[model samples]
Every structure is written in structure tokens, then in C-alpha cells.
Target: MNDSRFTPVDPVDLTARLVRCPSVTPVEGGALTLLTELLEPAGFECTRVDRNGTPNLFARWGRKGANRTFGFNGHTDVVPVGDAAAWTHDPFGGEIAEGYLWGRGATDMKSGVAAFAAAAVDFVRATPPDGAVVLTITGDEEGPSKDGTIALLDWMRTKGEAMSVCLVGEPTCPDRMGEMMKIGRRGSMSVTFQAQGVQGHSAYPHRARNPLHALVRLLDRLASEPLDHGTDHFDASTLAITTIDTGNSATNVIPARAMARVNIRFNDAHSSASIAQSLRDEADRVTAETGVTFELQVDVSGESFLTPPGDFVRLVTGAVTAETGVEPVLSTSGGTSDARFVKDHCPVVEFGLVGRTMHQVDERVSVDQIRQLKSIYSRILADYFA
Candidate 1:
């Protein structure tokens, strides 16, 4: 038996150390620091890429412009541990019991970051690849996301650092390991509408032009139809009317203003700009019919993107299948992740542990699965550089 496999980093130990860090979104929480300590000792050129007070780390294991660079992206910061009293184990304890490692970022991703970091460190030490290995870890993925990966990529551009291809270690499997990977993601955007009208006595409805009525009409128009049938690589676009309110407490008075917010997750069939134009046109149509003025504001989180199945996709799928013996399905069904940002820099796909428990109380991951993930990542590095 080869003792070398046990000589260096154990992904499970790294995961436990990370889970113990109190890094809730937008907080450094020492998670990045711990990772930097581990990587630097193993030969990674580590740099703290903090932006606008958001913590981020970028580490590379070889020359900057190696023939081909394989990049990794993940986040160490986690969502807040909601209702700590509701958990059976200490949320920050990183307990290894009952065959699972329990903690806040266990499934949602600290384990993922650890797995890849360990794999990168070990793979480089054991057999130096001709190409480079880069890891980008961020602390603001769970927050506004403006200063996290975006900041890293912006910095990379300014410094002329780039990856030939990138893999995001976000948990993409829903039911079990090796069952799924994300090939693309739907774009996300939000639109808020404010309507103005004349306020008057509710008793004589004819005397008042109620803004609430106009707002409701506008919302209905936006939500009344399907954005599209499912695309070849994505599900149909969806628009959800998240909120509508006027703050009116009196029954006898008609309010002069009302507001509503709608969120849309769109496929490659549309862009945020196109959707924004269509929505503004809808508001105009409603205003023409209702005689009320409307103001529309749009915020786009990310544009829809796809890394068409090719060599990169095949390499990832083959690795997961070889490790877990389950031929994985290529999917783009989940909510947004850092991959949405990585696609611009390089062709990116996501694979990792089962995420059924991500963001839930008592969130935990199987210990064996963590090791298995490390093996999978190790194999990917080997094959990509093979």
C-alpha cells in the first residue's frame, strides 16, 4: 500500500477547519486566511484580492502564462446560521458524527472549496503539471456578489491573468453525487414599478384615480404570459411577482401611489436588455389604457450563458462517471452561482457534492463524499493536463 496518499492534506480535515470559521456572507471570518495558510505552504502563489471590504483570494501553482491553465472557483463565506437554537449540533462546530460533517457551509460549499484546494495542493506536489492550477475563493458570494468573483475577474483582466478553462466547485448534484453538473445558467433580473395618480375620497370612486388599480393592471400584464418554452439547454423563462403594496391603512381614502417588484430568470433566448425593453413597453401600454403615470427600474444580476457541450464538458462528465459509477446528467436547472460570472472569463461548468441540504438547518455532508469529491477533482486535474 502506498503511504504517500496520506502524507499531505486530507480534504476532510480542511473542510472541518473551514466549517469552524464564522464566515457568514460579506465577512472574512478567517476562512480565507486558513486557506491561504494551507496553500502557501504547498507552493501556491497566494494573494489576497479584497475589494470594497469584501474578502477574496487568488492562488496559482505555476507560471502565470503556462501553456494552459485550469482554474477553480468557489466561495468560503456561508449564509447566516439561522436560528442557532434550532440545530442539534453547534452550527460552527464542524462536527463529524453520524457519518456526516455538520455545519452551515457543509453542503452549500465550504467543503467544495476545501476539496479543490486540497486536490490542487496535492496534485501539484505529487506530480507537477506543465500547466498552471488557479483557485479563486471569495467571501461575498452570499451577499451582494458585486465585489466577489467580479472583483477577482476584473483584477485578473488588469493584470493580464487568465485561465484557458475554469471549473466552479459549487454543489450541483441535487439527489446524489455524480448525478448532475451545470452546463449553463438562466440569467436573473429584477424590475420595480411605481405608479402615480390622484388621491381622493373612496366613497365616490369616480372622484379618485387610484394608483393601486393601475399597478395591479401592470403586474398582471407582466405575469400573464410565459416568457418562453424551455430552451435547448435551459428551462423556460419565469417571472415572479414578488411583492405589491400601497401602505394604505384607511378604507375611506384612495392612495395616490403604489409599487410592485417582479423578478425574471431568463434563458439564452433573451437578454436583460431585451426583457427590460419589453417590460417598459408593457408599462407604457398599461399607462395608455389606465391614464396613470408609471416609472420602471431594472437591475440585472447576470446575463444568461451556456458553455456548449464539448471537450470541457466531456472531461468533467467522464471524471464524475469514473469516480462514482453514475453517468451524470448535464443540467442548468438551479439558481445562479459564481459560474454565471466565470463564463465570461472562460468556459466553465460546476460539479460537487449533493446539495439537497444546502441552506437548510442542520446542513451536513457525508464524510466519504468529501473524500470522493477530492478524488474526482484530482482526476479532473490529471485528465485536463494529461
Candidate 2:
């Protein structure tokens, strides 16, 4: 029996309810609880796929081992609310002021989750699909992510659960609601370079090798060179020198070591291995030239991936165009999302609301966009199963 407390399917209302949960990063904060209450009543089978103390919910609205399954992926966790006093509204209040819902995760994607969840619940009730509708919501996306969607995927593989096609409800639009969808994302990696030098008095210039100088030269060379010109389906790769620190307080003394960090967002033209090799080659050249050796640390978050322009891409684009009269661009420009994990399981893409205020103070979303997004998702469901 459905819970009387969970009433009609309304994305905006559900979004407000979710935003009020305060589910920051690895915290449940009652967000997943609300989802279970709503979804279970709508005849969906729900399971708490918690792993390593992180909460994840997996819900399916059809028989297990179905021939075809469509999946929706999202995160309930939000980043911390920095400088809470700077906001015009409470960060967890979920207040609606002047046609907008004001709160953290409003655009970064409680709204996205609400839109898709509402759409799926209503769709299955109205005209049940022969296959299945699966929702994977995680509480660890904003944290280390070692146990969120990755954990769910591992569990699914063990249980023999499968999703043939998946859509990630991440905030993809930069400015407008229906302007963009991500077919792929650039690979991301970070490298930290530590250069060692002999410290000496500033007055004795030649006696000491300044690691700071060598670090700066290496950074300049890496930053000045473009990783590549734009690829056919992707933008040019980029490397950013995020920080260069010598930590030398005394002006007269050369620092014993200098440290710098660089983050690279690369397209399919390059892999982490290739980029790491390039960095090592550059460091080697600098070592030989400046007589300063470097120690490097690298972390590869995810490799670049693309779904390509095909039937599934056309299906989603056609739905977006039909609903909004806006020809959405099939873009591959964005930071990594859980879609990165889903891609290994099935073909995946991302679409959602405008992201202008995501991760910023006074984060908010238009109430109308939430409703419109629900309609778009409903249409996609209708078309995908037609």
C-alpha cells in the first residue's frame, strides 16, 4: 500500500523536500529516506545498497533480469555551505522566494534527481514499460567516491543486475535550462612536482640552486603549450598550474625545495599515461638543464569517454528539441560526473538544469524549470519505450 503522506508526483515539491535534508557529502541527512518513502509506494522495489558507511539507494520498477533496463543516476550529497552568513536564505531551508527554490543542491542537483524520479514514478504508473526503470542515487559523490556508484556497480555485477542504457542527471547546462547535454567528459588528473635545491644565502647567488626558479620554468613550459587542438568531437585538452609554493618566509634564504601542482583536463587525444610520460620528459629535461631533480605524484580520477553521435544520442536530442524547441548541443565539455562510472556498465549521457549557481553561495533553481525538466524526462521515457 502507498503511503498517504506521499501524494501526487510533483518535481518541484519533491525537490524542496530533498533540499531540506542537509545531506552534505557522506551524510544521509534524511534525503534517501524521503526517496524510499516516495518510490516504494509507487510500486518500485527499493534496496539500500550501503557500502563502507556510505548510503546508496537502488530502485527498480520491473522484474529482475529483464531484457532491457533504463537507468537514471544522480547524487543526493552536496558540498559544504561555506560562509553561511553570506546567503540571503538558509542553506538547508529549501525556501521558495520569487519563483526560485533557494538552498544548497538546488542546481547542483537535488532538482535533477527530483525531476527524473518524479518522471519515472509517473511514467511507470501511467504506462508501464516492458523492460525496467532503475534509479541509482548515491550519498558519496561529493566525497572520495570510493564507495558510492562504484560500490553499487560492483554489487550489481554480483547480483546480475543490468542496465542497458543509462542517463546521468547531472547539471549540464551552463546558462540556460535546455542548451546543453554532455555526451562525454574530459579525463582529469593531477600532478604534484617537488623540486629539491641547495639552500644558501641570497647574497651568495651561484652557491645555491633555487628550486623555485626551476619549478616556475617547468610550469611555464607545461602551461604555455597546448595539449592539442580541438578534436572532432572534443575541445582541446588543457593543463592548469593550480599552485606554485616555495613556502619561504625569509627573503634572504633560498628555499630547500619548491612544490607545484598541475591539473589536466584532457580529451580522448591523450590518456593519463601519456600525460604522465610527458610530464616526466619535461621534468627530465628541466633536471638536466637546471641540475635540479624532481619528485612527482600523480592521481588519475577518470579517463575521457564518449558515446558518439548515434541512435541513443539522437533519441535524447530529439526529445529535448521536441519539448523545448531548443536544439541542444551534444557537448563533451564538463567536469567528471558519476556518468564516468556508468559508462563502463552501459552507454551513458548527462542532461539537467542550468548550473550557474552550483557550488556557490545562494544556490537556487527556478521552480518552472523543475516542472519543465520533469516533462522532458517523461517524454524521453515515453519515446525510449515507444
Candidate 3:
């Protein structure tokens, strides 16, 4: 049951192993095989669940009668490296130069996964915990996410797996590794508005109701005031008009309809339903003002959540302080992430290397940073389950 093959391994090698997999979203690319080959020999049972064509791996290793389980959630799939010519090195080079690993997904996530995998191997090799360590990695986080962790969690529920606290290895730090941990995230929703009007000649002002004029008023009302000043744990919600369309072929003719779309990054101050209601109210006011009728459609993606300053937060913060001498801030300020889906199932937090290069051309992570990240993750495990 000894997994010496994975033990005493360098994080740089682990990152190389992960980057070699061309596991773009929803593609296996042998990443799961690489993970299983390294983990199974360590007395861990690994299973690959292919739900709706997305590959997800769930592996666990520990004592038989373990009551507590710590789960690590992450994605193996990476965003496509657009414009390979723009990168100095091969997007999948996994090369080490200038103290950094050059490749796509190096910093966005693959580094974190590799570091955690190495640390898990080291942890079990040194002192096997009384509890189990479960890794839930999916290949759909970068895509639609319809078949990623969401489906895997459902499968876990059916199998009666007990997950106490989950930590996501997303690139959460802003400036430096261990500088921050994401305890919560803001909710996101998209809205589309369409106003109907009568088409007529531009000179016939009395003959046509201009829908563009009505949409302008509606947008002004939605944008003129702040959604909320700020919440205690979250910043103020924001609504931005992303697109406005009025297909008028001739300048002398008035369009029959107008369409607009807006995206809202909202805090706990509002729910998607409440935001939709606000849109409806504005539509009503516009109708009253100009006698124009319109339709509004709102798509609620996810809700906001906070983990609070608790044992999970303390476990990670203490580890960062001990390892890097940095007091990480617990912040909820960021765009949406798969952690949003995870927060619904368990108290989830995100911590990893700095994300200054995620989703960018020539994405890279420092070799030294990867090693330090492995140490940090190991310390987190020791502090939480020791």
C-alpha cells in the first residue's frame, strides 16, 4: 500500500505531468489516468464518472471507520490557449525557465491540482490521518459546467459519501501566494429587455411611439442609482448594460422594436428574483410614461454566499501565516466560479497561487511558487486533520 512513487516527488514534476494532458474542457486527455496512476497505489480507491460526456474523478484514501472527510475540489480541464503564436513558448511546453513553468493553465489551476496531489501523497506517506481525504476533480469547469461537479455531487449523495468541509484550489490570491482566501462570491445574472413600438416615418412624430426613447429611459433608471451602497461582507452590487440593439435600416425610419441586455454582479442585498422584479417595475414605469409595452427576461446563474470566520477559514489562515508569514484576508469580491456551485453543498473556500496570469496568453506559474503552494496545502491538511 505504500505509494513511494508519488512520495518525495517535486512539485515541478507534478506540474509537468498535469500540463502534459491536453484536457481542455469536457476532454479527458488522460489527466484522470495520470491522477489515478499516481493515487491508486497509495491505498486510495479511484473511480471515474462520465456524466453526459464530461469526465469526473472521485478518489478517497484513509482508514475504514473514518468519520470525518476533507474534500478537495478542482478542475483538470483548462481554458483553450488562444493564439499560440502570441505565446513565447509552446502553450503546453511545461518548460521551466526564468524560475517559472511556461504553459496555459499553469497558474489558472493545473499547478494547484498538482501541488495538492503531491502534498496528499506526502501527507499520507508521513502520517496517515484518522479521516479520509477525497479529491473531486472534474473536466467541465471551464465549459458549460452542466456535467461537472454538479453531477458528481449528485452521484456522491446517492453513494452516501460524507464531505464535511471542502476547499477549492482555484487561483484566489490577487498579488501574492497566501495573501488571500475567497470565503464567498457575488451572484451573477443576465437580463434582456425588449420594447415594442410602431414603425413610422421619422417626420411623423405623432404617428409612431419610439421604443428607443422608452429603452433609454428604462436604462437610465436602472443605471442612475446604485443597487446598494455596500454589504458588510460584500461590496455594492453592480448592473452594466452590455448591449443595446435597434436594427434601423434607414435613418429616416423609426424602428419597431428595441433590445437591450445587462449583466448584474449582485451581492447579498438582492436575489435574482428581486432583480427581475426591479426590471418589471421599471418596465411598468416606462409603459406609464410613454405607453410602450416591453418584455424582460432574467437568467439567474448563481447566488452569493459567505463561509464566515470559522474552523475551515482558521485552518487555512493559520497555515498561510505559518508558511508564508502572510495574514490572508477572507474576501468575497470576485466574478463567479465553480465554487459558487460547491458553496451550496458544503462550507467552501478558495485558496491557491496568485491569479495574475489566469486565462491569459502564455499563462505561467513560478516554480518556486508551486513548491511553496505544495507546502501550504500540506500545512492546511496537517492543521485541519492533525
Error of 1 at 223 (Å): 1.5
Runs of candidate 1 with Cα error greater than 4 angstroms are: 1-6
Evaluated at residue 233, the lDDT of candidate 1 is: 88
lDDT of 2 by residue, 72-119 (tens): 999999999999999999999999999999999999899999999999
Candidate 3: regions farther than 4 A off: 1-6, 63-65
How accurate locally, in lDDT, is each candidate?
0.92, 0.92, 0.87
Which ten residues in a row are the worst by lDDT in model 2? 1-10
* 10 residues in a row with least lDDT, candidate 1: 1-10
lDDT at position 81, candidate 1: 90
Candidate 3, 28-112: lDDT as tens digits: 8888899899889877889887898999998888753368788888888999989999998888878888888988879878898
lDDT of 3: 0.87
- lDDT per residue for candidate 1 within 33-68, as digits (tens), equals 999999998889999999999999999989998889
Enumerate residue pairs that collide in model 2: none
**Candidate with the larger TM-score of 1 and 3:** 1
Indicate which candidate wins on TM-score.
Answer: 1
**Higher-scoring candidate on TM-score, 1 or 2:** 1
